[model samples]
Target chain A: MTNNILYSIKDLSKSFSQSNKKVTALRNVTLDINRGDFISIQGPTGGGKSTLLQMLGGLEKPTSGMISLDQDDLEKLGEAKLTNVRAKKVGFIFQNYNLIPTLTALENVQIALVPLGIKKLESERRALAALESVALSDRANHFPSELSGGQQQRVAIARALVKNPEVILADEPTGNLDEETRDQIIDLLVNLNKESGITIMLVTHDSNVAKRANKNLHISNGVVTTRS
Target chain B: MFFTYLRREISKRKRQTLLVSVALGTSIGLIIVVNAASAGIGDAQKTVLSGLYGIGTDISVTKSIQPTQGGRGFNFGPENADSSGASTLNQTRLTVPIFSGTFDGQTLKQIKSTKGVSRIAATLKLNQIIFKGSIAGTASNPTTPQDPNARPRGFGGGNFNIDMTSIEGVDTSLTNVGPLSGVNIDKGRIFQASDANSQNVLADSTYALAQKIDVGSTVSVGSGTFTVVGIVSSASSSPETSANLYIPLAQAQTLSSNPDLVTNIYVAADSSSNTDSVQKAIEALLPDSTVSSQADLAKNLSGSLSSASSLVNALSKWLSIFVLLVAFLIAILFTSSGVTRRIREFGTLKAIGWKTNRIVRQIMGESLVTSFFGAIIGLAIGVVGIFVVNTIAPTLSASVVSPGRFGGAAPGGPGGPGVPGFQPPAGGFTGRGTGFGRAAENATTLKLHIGMNVSTLILGVLIAILGGLIAGAYGSWKASRLSPAVALRSVA
Candidate 1:
């Protein structure tokens, strides 16, 4: 682990019980993610790409070995501390644009700041700024149902970037969009990464998305391999 | 932000919100209506009792007349023949009520000394009978020798008329606790201290109106002509007063030939709670007499009022409770289901770093807002129910068997005039048949008026909140159990 490394992973493994059988999603995986790294993971469905991204986001716990973010062991932290790590250090974007249906696009973005204990007015201001960065400020008050797929995905990206987390974990962020909308979303995410220096770990099945990342990794049957 | 989110969420799911609110609201409304009806029945009971025992009377003591006690006797004789040889007779007798037996004034003293007795008044309840007719000249022939075994020819020959009036001997000095306390003077004045031993009389409004009697008119009773000094009516809604005529106790005792004796003793306790003890004490002193507290007297109340009281106390109360419990269960189930449906939403929030407590808070906030709206709807429904009850104004009739009147022995023998040749005068007395000593049992009718009080309204609100809390708690518990990984997996 170097001084520039934001995440240090060592021989981590994760398994799930499926119909009383142990199915491993990640096995003896070793990885290092440095600050400002744009890492893309590519694999088939159920091949541990989303599992690895969830682990890096602190949304899942590894069954063995150790993983750390900024010197704090993810496996050793209590529930409250783990939640705090997730709240202020990591953000997530789902493939389906998981914005709350009841709230406007701006409020969906502001929700990320809720767990950080920010005041409502300050949260709204920062949310607006995040939406502007994503070029979705014009649709800030539009509900998720009222927005196009690209616009909704942009709102989801704004929500992830609003907290200024050190890393954003996006699982197939453009998986559900058409080519034009997918290109627009990918451009927005790339711009956020280039300007803000935010680390991004994206899991995608599309080789085009993987080619844009600074580092590309492939996994199959719970095994990881870096692409040249 | 919290409130805005809550509002949006509630508005988005209108059907679910309405379901919970209407269930809870109907339950709360039923509770309010039932409680109000119970209060109204209580007031009606007070009115009925006031008609029977007067306003402040808490305990009443009386003795039932025995079969061997006595019977009414009338005597008519001829000093000679009036011109055509017919005997003219006119007689009026004031006697104690067939159901009541007199006790000396010493009993009143004993009751006054009883523990918790605050005020005591004694009264003599009497019945005045008037007979007016003349025997035929041929019916009572003095010169003719009558065979001892011969059947009389004039057995159905008399042209006599009879009338009976209910009267009360009131202790004017203690009107605060007796039957007189329940009357209002319609004309003239009530008795004064100086009128205690005087020959003044008060006529009940109904009786006076029927007889065309007014203030300063004269009415005959017990061989004496009394000037009607006042016209009085019952203070309650009952059409009939406690008695047809009110007379001074001294004059009643002298005229009825039962000196220093009273048939009924009315006692007012120091407080309502002490009435039982006072009744017990009086019962101990007068073991053979009937001593009744207000509650015991209420048992004697029959008719629509009593039925309403029973329905309000038993049926309505239980129904309200049953409906409230069902409402709470429905609310809890609905809220839990709503949370279950939003599992993916909650999982996403948890992944975004929202604490379990915050998610729980949001669920509870939604449930509570629904319940608050439910409370408002319930209040409106309850007010409407109360208004309907008042507008209907159902008249409930209540009859209390005057003490010693029920299941008692007949006072007199077979009905017949004292004269030899006067049969039962066509059809006994004018007003009533002399059947088995049945005393006049009067009924009081009152209009029921439901009322709303502050405490009941507060209770309705509190009940709605409680229902909300219970449902919210269950929903929150379910939401808290959803681990983000598992919740998201289920939705995925």
Candidate 2:
């Protein structure tokens, strides 16, 4: 591991009991990603790709593992500090484009910056800049319903980028878009990754989408095999 | 930033927010009005008491006796005898023996020198023999001729009427006679020290009316001719007794044709002095006569009225509590439901690294804002209700709602529009029946006295805020416990 390692996971495991039987989502997974790495995680459905992503994002604590971001242990930080780390260091883009309905595109992005204790006017400026980065600056004042599916996805990406986090995680960000919109979003995300030098970790089932990443890790039966 | 979140949340759920605010406002407004009305009743009671007795007296004493067919004899045994009579009493009577002995100058000097004794004024109780006209001649009187048209009368062989009278001799030094002293003189001048020699007297209005006499008219009582100098009104004196002529005590004594006989002794003591000591000293000096204090009389009167008023006040207070409690509970339930519906939104914020405390603060802030508006609306309604009630029943003495009455206005100015400078009648508290009757006539006036004070308003808002906080905190806590993976998957 180099000093540029942004996140490392070792022996990370998570299981759920269904009807008195254990179902393991992830088992003994070991992975490390350096800064500015754009990695795509590909696996069959229910193959623990989402679970592995959640643990890496510090949104979920692993059952047994040593997970560290930079030099800080994810399990050792208290709830408040954990929240701070998540807000300042990681940005997530979801498949549903979970934009707050009541807020406009700008406000949705601004929500990510609220936990950072930024002032309203400054947060709005930064959020607008982030929206422009995704070429949706004209839709900054539109609500999620007013925008098209592709435009909403762009807004979600803008919300993620507004925080300027070290890593950006996308859990099926383009899963709901049509093929053309999906290709457009992949181009936008890749361009963002290259321009900002932000680490990108995405879980995708589309073969064409997976090929755009700098690296691919294929997962099966709770195991990951890195492919150069 | 917190306010922004609060404002956004409230505006986002406009309908729910309105429902909660309206419910809370109406409840609080009603409480203010009801409380004001109740307080008015309490004030009325105090006024009635103070008017009937002096402020120094908080209790009353009256003789308790069982009803008996025959006349009861006096018991002159021990000084502290337990009369052991039934609680039902026809009336209380203070009896003093009449002694017709020349008080040698030395005896008068001795009385003046007595300890614990204040100044005393002598009084003469006179019984009048009234005759309508000349009596008809009886058969036993041979020289007396009877008119054939005149019917023979039963008993004493004449149309005779008996009238009871008492001459209260007030000394110039002995002023301040409780309710009697409070009598408003309608006309003429009160009895002055010099008037004692001029045969001038202050007569009760009722007595003057019955006698068909006005001020400056001379009326004969016993052997004295008294010119009415003033007419006075009194609520305490009975209708029958108020008809008697009030002559100077010295004149009554002289007119009795026996200046040495004094029926009763009236004394005035310093209001701040220990009445018990003064009473004991008087008892020692006037061993043959009975001594009584005004405090003993007031206590007996106050005790009876208070017992009944207490029960009514307690019932009204409890009713107010019940209404407020139900209102608060409804508010809590509504707030809880509102918070539950917004759980997903809270979870989103939590997942985005917003602290649980921040979420809680947002919820509380929303509730506080809503309740603040509700309280304002409620106060407006209460004030309007009070004004309407006051208008319909002006006699209810809507003074209770006046500023500075009943703990001042309700935070703002709920008491302003009624009657300016109006004060609830001095004797406001009457029996429940009386109080209700007045309230029915003018509820606004009644409520003005009972309206909520600043403290009550603050307490109400605090309770509302607490409800909001609890609901919000519960929602946030539930959101926090969710695994981000599960939440995100659920969204998908």
Candidate 3:
């Protein structure tokens, strides 16, 4: 049962110092994620949903708590080791579709493997296959600016997938898209999690998108409440 | 992957990179050219001085003529003097023959025995008047007459109107050595040691033309008519590049009615580097004599040329450091601005697990590439600038000219026995001194040699690379410090 748990979080807390004032974003949150679990975290604005995703990605340190991802405690790992974990064990998708504008879609995806030091030919092959999984192979050569919002987010998803990580941390990944494009992105992510058995954790403001996940965690005013 | 990414990034920001590189190149180019010219002038200065002072001769020792008790007032030139010579026009107006200082055979022997003294030659210079053939209508040479005739109100003896000429008696054996080594025979041969006792003469081309005298023609000199054997052009000619007549040392002494005395002695050292020490030693040896060295000649140079050389040397010394500093700062500022604009990009790279040191290296590579291009451009500009400068500037440049203590003279003139012209022919006109015998004056103009040498070229490259690194260090630091979290943060 312990080996099956992908993430085990206990008494997690986070705060920010803004203009000489401390504002708590997360308070005393305890959660557990099993392998192959597709979890969506929803909350009102400034309620630590995105902050929790950031922690899962090893992008930020928690003020206090224990976050164990696949038996490795993120808090205990040094920056270099944490980066290694991020690079090899987890991937990220962002609300703004953070694709390097200077690179084509294929290159944007290929960059995810840069730290792995793959040869260019092998990296491009993996990038193309990842883009194909997102149904974006036809748009592989297009830059982010040349792509529509939905297509850009799909490219970002491809970038996250190309690393073949065990889990994906997405923060409002479809928030910037139109209604139709948003639903299409949801179906694509659901298909990825169901078919690949990769654990997916996302922060979304939309309840409809939350309902599609296997598990949902709701937070309000820095405190968490569970929903099945 | 970094290089691929970097190349695209550079292309994207081509305008900014080009602007920075061009600015750096211009500064580097200036430093290169100015330093090269400075070094060139230094070399040219030495070459010019050696040519003027006498190549192979380390130290010059000349006796200064002083007035005696009995010898008196102005009996400037002979009543029947050579009216053909015009050299006196550019010389000190007081052209009267007087009692001159002399260094004897014993002194010459003593000097030759002195340690560190290599080879020695003696010369005697005299002022004489020729009363015969007038060298009136000759084609004028294209050299300038620097000194103008500003005849004094009451100068020279009354009722005497004869042409005054300058005559030099040289050790014909050593004419091909020292400064005389540069004297070329435009038409005929120069005098040789074997001709010392012969009545042969080498006439200055300009003087020969002025007097309508040709080589191998009989010409009246002093009290003798010697056969003309050679025609030569010399730097020591009276007005400047013109040739003065030359006769064998023995013949000159016999004609002047003087013997056994030479007014100046030139000593050659083993090498030019030893000139300063040899000069000091000679100064100590001939305390009453005037000792001139190549360094002395350089210091006495005057005019715009002196200022130009001094200004170039100063500029080369300090301007490079200042300009290169400014260039370094500009590169830093430019790179820093690029870093500011790419904060998100840097953040994203770090977020993707790219290490801080890797980012730093990427930035450094960009700077090194740009700096390499800048150095090449700078070298091109410098080479072109050197050619341009060399093309416009005149050849033979000298800044400080001390006509009083340092001037040109023939390698040989006999200071032997005295036969005063016409004696004043009073008291048999016991020839006394007028303090004008050996004028403390010389003229040397050097042609400018301007180009880049290996040292200056190496210096330019070093500055370019160092400037790039200095600027890159800051950009890399800023890049390395960018937190990966910035990419995840809200745009707000």
Candidate 4:
């Protein structure tokens, strides 16, 4: 109930239909994400870590139970409202960087502010500022294919920062990066979290990154167990 | 943001864009080319009609040959007697009598007085004896061909030639109007008012050239020795109407012994738009005459040639549909494939708070750009196709038959191209053609006029754009429906 709590998950569950078979991706997942908390959801492949992050970001609806983001029930909200919630309150960082292949790094960053209906000039200014913060101001004009993996991830971080959302939902944010690039990207997310007081929910298979989080939630077969 | 992304994506996939555009463009181009040819054929039809009816002349009025039912021996009425028959006109039928189906002064005055009537020219068409190797200008009797194998004026009349040829005696003043007026004078000047009473005549260029006659030459036609004052190039005149000699109407009426008469009257309406009204007025005044407009002339010229026109029209219509469908399908398929390839890209966009409509709009923008390029390429292909048609087959002649007409076509020479070899039909519309040796008319040489007009060009471009957008919209809507979760989960 406190103003610091970003999300409260209770009896959260999700299932998917795979070729006529019911696949339970998550079950009875409960967790609390405090404001500015750097939380990592660690699990193996198909262990529902990504689904949990999707639920937290209001990108996907839970089939059962409740997900309250910023004190509003995500499942109770309409599609457009949930989308707006995602737009105004949550930003995503994907493993593949998920930069629109066509857009340059700066345009990709500008995209985050597009749904907010900000003026073009202001959007571009904010986008550039975000790129500068990610230390890729020089690579702002480079397309995704034009930049190295580390640089693309950094650009992706700038895109997330452009919206200045309260929650950054990172889904295996460093999954496809080399070791050094991964560490650098992890540092960037952690820095964003520590410096901006931005709530960070990181999904990864690496226990090491999870261990670095303020709170680590481990998932095995749809169950979440917190690690001290 | 959407547009910026669209621009970047389209340019980034320039090769794909070009390939897709070319595919759609070629289809659109084919449609343009086919329609242009069809348009050319339509123009050719109009040209032949204009030439026959007189350039700018809209309606042609000629007295019908139908004979009145009751006629005693040696007594004749227009409805009961043939011009070639041995009969004399009675007092009551004096306006249109025997031995001459030509209109009289009263009928001419009536026609000229009609509303919307601008100008009228009356011509008395006749057949006179051909004076071969002899300058005998007497209508007393027929002359023998001194050289029978001498090339009969532009026909397959080899050796077995007809003893008589056509002569048109037109009003000297009215020669500035009518079918005889618009033709080009290849040599010398047309008939002057002074020449109406004087001994002067105009000759068809085809006949003059074949006969080796020119201006200042004297030739004996009928019983008159007249100086050939001009050589005329005629596109409309079949050998039947392309009179070997053009004399004063008065002189021709005298020679034919049907004074103050004419067989056909050409009427020029004030404007093309008034032709129908003028034609109706002429028909009302001269109730017994057959009044035909330029449209009627073209319609009556239907034959195997019109079959070709019909084929081209049908082909253009169906091919247009085919090309449009193909264009739509290509855009749809291309957009769908593109969406599939960029699934994650779209997912990212959706995850980035882009509304479904926004994504759809970007897809449409890309599709439109691709189609715009296609339209340009298609127009180019169309123009090139038209040029090729003009070069490959500049002039095409297809024989046509009209009512009450069979003609012999004048041979093509240096006078002009695309002149239909006019041969009179084998038989007139009415079985009476056998009564007077009517010549068979050959087809008019049709020159293709294929060019893109602004309206058609605009319409074609519009179709291409609409087609591309419609298909793109469909594909985009499908893309919009793609759940970001589903797309992100799918590796491919």
Q: Which lDDT tens digits does candidate 4 get at residues B1-492?
A: 767877897899998798778877887778887787787777777666655556767787765454333331111122332333221222211112222356788988988899898989888877553212211111221122344444323321111122444677887876656757667777798777777777788887766766788999997655668898888876553332345678888888876678877887888888878889899877778787778886777666664446657878898999888877877787788788888988998888888788888888888888988889888987787778777877886655655444433222321112111111223333312121221233234356655668776666777788778867887888798897899877877741
Question: What is the C-alpha lDDT profile of model 2 across B197-302, one tens digit per residue?
Answer: 6688777665677667789998766556778888875332222222245567566556656465544344445544656766676566656543545434322333
- Give the interface RMSD of each candidate: 1.1, 1.8, 1.5, 1.7
Candidate 3: tens digits of C-alpha lDDT, residues B333-376: 99898877777767766776777787888888888777777788
Residue B387, model 1: Cα distance from true site in angstroms = 3.8
How close to the true structure is residue A177 of candidate 1, measured as C-alpha lDDT? 95
Rank ordering of all candidates by DockQ, starting from the highest: 1, 4, 2, 3
Q: What local lDDT does model 4 show for residue A75?
A: 82
lDDT score at residue B382, model 3, on the 0-100 scale: 86
Candidates, DockQ: 0.60, 0.49, 0.49, 0.56
lDDT of each: 0.83, 0.61, 0.71, 0.73
In model 4, which runs have C-alpha deviations exceeding 4 angstroms? A8-32, A44-47, A63-68, A71-73, A76-79, A119-121, A218-227, B1-3, B57-178, B186-203, B207-231, B235-241, B245-315, B391-393, B406-439, B443-449
Give candidate 2 regions above 4 Å deviation: A17-23, A218-221, A225-228, B47-51, B54-57, B62-159, B162-177, B180-185, B188-208, B211-319, B394-490
Q: Is the docking of candidate 4 incorrect, acceptable, medium or high quality?
A: medium
> How many Å off is the CA of B272 in candidate 2?
17
Fnat, model 4, is: 0.64
Model 4 residue B272 lDDT?
Answer: 78
Candidate 1 residue lDDT tens string, B1-492: 678789889998899999999999999998888888888898788777877778999998999855342246555445523665555677777888655788897888888888899999898888887777865556344313245455545532446666678778889787688888888889999888788988889998888888889999998778778899999987888656777888999989989999999988999999999988898999999898999877887887799999999888896779888999999999999999998988888988899899989988998999899998889888988999999999998989887776664223242433433345543333223342321123345577789998996699889989999999999999999989888777766755
User: What TM value does model 4 have?
Assistant: 0.74
Q: Please report, as a value between 0 and 1, the fraction of native contacts recovered by candidate 1.
A: 0.70
True-vs-predicted CA distance for residue B392, candidate 2, Å: 3.0
